[model samples]
Target: MNLNSKIEMQNSRSSSEICYENFMIFNSQRAGFTIVELMVTLVILAITLGAVYTTFIAQQRSFVTQDQITESQTESKIAFNILTKDLRNAGFAYPVYSNPPTFSGSVVPSENNNAGRDALTLVSGSQQVATLAQPLIIGQNIISITYTGSARFNLTDMANISIDGIDFSVITTCSFIGIGTDCDDNFVLTLNRGMNKPIPAGRPLYALTASTYCIVTDVTDTDNYLDLRRIAGIATLASCSGALPADVERVAENIEDIQFAYAIDSDADGLVDDQNANGVFDPGDYLTPPLPANSKILAVRVSILATTGKDDPSIEPSTKPYYSSGITLENNITDVSNDKQRRNIWSMEVALRNPR
Candidate 1:
């Protein structure tokens, strides 16, 4: 009611009105986020989710690739193991012969009246003649062998012939002759004594020749594969005698290439003789011995190239690092010059079936 009281009352009323307006503005500001802020938040969330999804996908792909690699490695190892095991047992005969079998130089006659008579003659150790005294008749399991020449013989069967000593039956038509007379010659057998007179004498009987055959269903081209045949029989020549049994078999398929290197003990140190005297494994510049009777085949390095992916996916191209100490495929047959798919190779080392 006084002058000072009147001024204070007027100021108080103005302040109250300003307070009400400020409260209303604050409520409106605090109601919700602005459009710009909402959009920025959503964008940040999308970016984070995208990064996480990308990382997850990358990891998943890596896992898949690793799994595929492991599977390929496992398959290759299995195949190699099986092949080595069988190869080591090749040319095995029960009751080892007194003298190894030898391949005779006699030509198989085409008119022998037998389906499997085209086989090269097998002689016993005592028989040194070029021809057999008795013609190797069909279904006759007994064979004599001898060694007469410097060359060793590998007898492969043209028909499934059972050995007199061995019990197992061999596959037919997949036979071969190596290091001795070439079985590729076509000849005709005659009843004349002069034509068959070259048959050797005193040669011990050997098992009938066993053919080695394999089914190559998945081959893209026949030329890419070698039709390796097995030959089992006797030898009639010099150091070779008695029932010398030889069996060569096709133990594997998909063998894109085969290379043989001899680990000869030239110095006879009871270890692989280093022909180059480099004291290190110089597979690139090493000496290879003659086959069929090399005597010491310390190790056999094999490389097989195979394709897992079919024509559809086009086989994803990739580059992988090789371990430093790992065996390089430089000398592999599959890795020869001008080979495109040699990168996909399985390598292995096999000891000879007969180390002697």
Candidate 2:
């Protein structure tokens, strides 16, 4: 009932009021966000996610395009390597003749023949498949030869009988002496035509092949991929015009077109003659079948066009550019301008290493 007791009560009351004010402030601070704040946060998160997703999709599309381009480049490189090697070895140990050679030159070119595409036939005797077991005399049609297990001689397969690697004769007939016996190691090959020159004993006999290279679409493949095909034993231009043989192999795939230009030594000066004074070898400078009497092919320019196997939807057909020159690619098929496919062209100039 004194002044001290009354002051204590008043202090306690003031303390309780302060505690209540602090609790109210705490509760107000803990209250959830406003609807407008939540919407704003959501919009920001959505924008950030959209940006990230867009970047990822762009990168994925770029990766796909690069992968396709790499595939096309690899195919082109393989085709170029094969063509360069064969062209360099053209005329390797060709037959020497007193008169003009019965066949054409070692590298026969059919320029712009197959639907505006070029065809080439290469003759080489570097693949030695057998050796003469006995001396071959002139005017002899039959001779004894020995070979290893690697020698695969089939009927109608041509072979060259060479003497000292200079004089040679082609075997037209491949009649074997022992029919019932296993002739894997040794056999007698009968040449319907007499030998051009006498080959001594122990000389190597080479397996001759006329391989023609051209671009075509394989009907056997469900995708109908464009392929570079090597037609073995086919030497004439007609070989490029006919339907593909069932036994033919696809040397390279995705090859859309092929072109050839020849550097000829028309004057026989041992150097390439431009013929038309142009720096580049044009179609006019090429040599066809039944080549001129003294003209020789020194080098060949091969251009191959390759394409990505699939069409890219990102590439607009209206904006896509045609990589190949305007030329017919196949029979009833021409260079497509709106295919929406990526394409590349690779060219190689190869000098003949064994020019006869």
Candidate 3:
């Protein structure tokens, strides 16, 4: 081959080789993604994150709602159980209550304290942890009683025990419970036993405890929410309507309202008659306030209105479905809480265990 031709061929071959190498380097450098692809990937990721966030929010809200509902229901149920146990012991005489009443209910305006709800007072025999061989007595330094029921009687559990209408404060006895007992496990009064009027065996003597259930304001929310409380002890029902009892305890919270009504078996029939004919009661069948006579109190109907203490913000804030609870609160403000709080009313009829 000619020298000029050979040089031209070699130069052409080198240029082709260089061009191939340049193409390979360019392809390697372009290995990643374009701006448009990156943008598309980001949009997909954003959609996925938004969906996950929405689900998490919904679940959290559901948990809050469930918790509120569970708490309200549990509190209400507890109150109901306590009331049932106490009311079942009302007028707890051997056969039936015949006297002017060791107890009374639907407390008057002065004792009730609040306007919307009703209160009830019940009396029963002091429960005993041990048996009794002899009669109970009031001694010089202490007062001890012969007990017959299953309820345990202790100084800590009992504030003021009464004999008829007389409170323990008048007995001039030590506040501590006596521990003296005979062969039958009967505890002694540990006082000057010479003086005391033993409650007649047939007449039946009791420890004389009293209970009053009503609605009142609590420390947490003194303005809107209300709580159910039991006011009890000496001189509550036994004495005249003068002052409220010192012993008070909260039964439940979020109790919006409580109402008490009396039922009578005027005809001595087993079933209660519906009075007022609104399909609810017949005239003289139900009494808002029990009659003064002890025999008139046959059965009691308790109605409790409860609510969730928390507000549901999904609705208009502070705006309730019901216009009013039919009365104003202690704050002198009407329409109850200023938010949407769920509420419900529960009613129960309890028959007197002992009645004339």
Candidate 4:
């Protein structure tokens, strides 16, 4: 063998070996992605999933908030409707006297002043004073109504009395005659002792004249025994005074606030008189110059505040302001905290049944 031939054979062998090694390396490289590429792909997938999850959560929260608001609004509307209906029917039979008698004989100055009006004086038929012509005395349900009279004391011919001693003042054109017959004459005035009223054994006769007084402040106390006796009028439970007629009830246990604002026709002109003089009807403000003697309440605004969860969850902006500005209850004159709470609030407005 020659030296040149041997050299060429060795070179060819080395070249072959190099080519085999390169082929193996190229195949391995093409078989899979780099670690960096794999990591990037995983990161992109995580981001996409995270965005989708976050969007779902946001939508869920929005739905919850909307549901709560709807529930609150519905409850408030129902409560207001009930209250307005009863108030419109208040003092239905009695002629709205300009000089309505107060327990102190002092005229009730403001229509919103319920101190005496709410505390009805029950004058039994036996207590009716024939000489005075007053249907109620002791032992009777003396429901003093402030209704608009006929031509004798229509809205046009009446004036609001502003005297200090007079809670309700009126200047009438003639003897005020209410709608239909006298409300006092139509209904039978009987003494109704609340469920709490003690019944004497062996005596069908309940105490007609007792110093004891039955007090009702809220709807919960409006049971059959505590219910205000409806004069000659509708027989349905809806006609009874207060909110519920012993059937429907409040749902949430955390309810903290329930407020009322009355829309009154101060001048009996069949128009709501906004005390703030804003011309827009708002129930929160007291009737300007107070409700006239013969005026009627036309509408009501109700507000309720409640908590959802058992414990307050430390929500942001925990407290909310009143729904409407320049409108508030009589007790809220200084402190507007009626609706202040740790959880939620519901508010609404309603119109009364009958109004002058």
The number of clashing residue pairs in each candidate reads: 48, 0, 11, 17
lDDT of 4 at 288: 31
Error of 2 at 302 (Å): 1.3
Which residue runs of candidate 1 sit more than 4 Å off their true CA positions? 1-25, 94-259, 264-274, 277-299, 305-348
User: Which candidate, 2 or 4, would have the higher lDDT against the true structure?
Assistant: 2
Candidate 1 C-alpha lDDT tens digits along 1-356: 79999999999999999999999999988999989999999999999999999999888866765565555456545655654554454344322322222222111111111111111121112212222334454444333334234433233322222233332222222123444432221232121112211223443323333222222333345444422222334332221122335444344434343233445544446676665668776564333333333244455554444432222122332332232222233332222222212224665655554443
Task: List TM-scores for all candidates, in order.
Answer: 0.42, 0.76, 0.63, 0.38
lDDT of 2: 0.69
**Predicted structure with the largest TM-score when compared to the true one:** 2
Tell me, by lDDT, which candidate is best.
2
Error of 2 at 327 (Å): 7.6
Report residue 321 deviation for candidate 4 (angstroms): 6.5
Residues forming the 10-long window of minimal summed lDDT in candidate 4: 205-214
lDDT of 2 by residue, 20-42 (tens): 99999999997899899999999
Tens digits of lDDT, candidate 4, 1-356 = 99999999999999999999999999988998989999999999999999999999888876776666566556445544443344444332222342232221111121233222122111111111111123233333222223232211122211222111112223332233455222242322222211212222221111111010112223554321122232211112232232321122233333334444556665757777767877675544543333456555566554544433222222333344442241243333222233322344455565644232
Flag the better candidate by lDDT, 1 or 4: 1
Score candidate 1 by lDDT.
Answer: 0.39
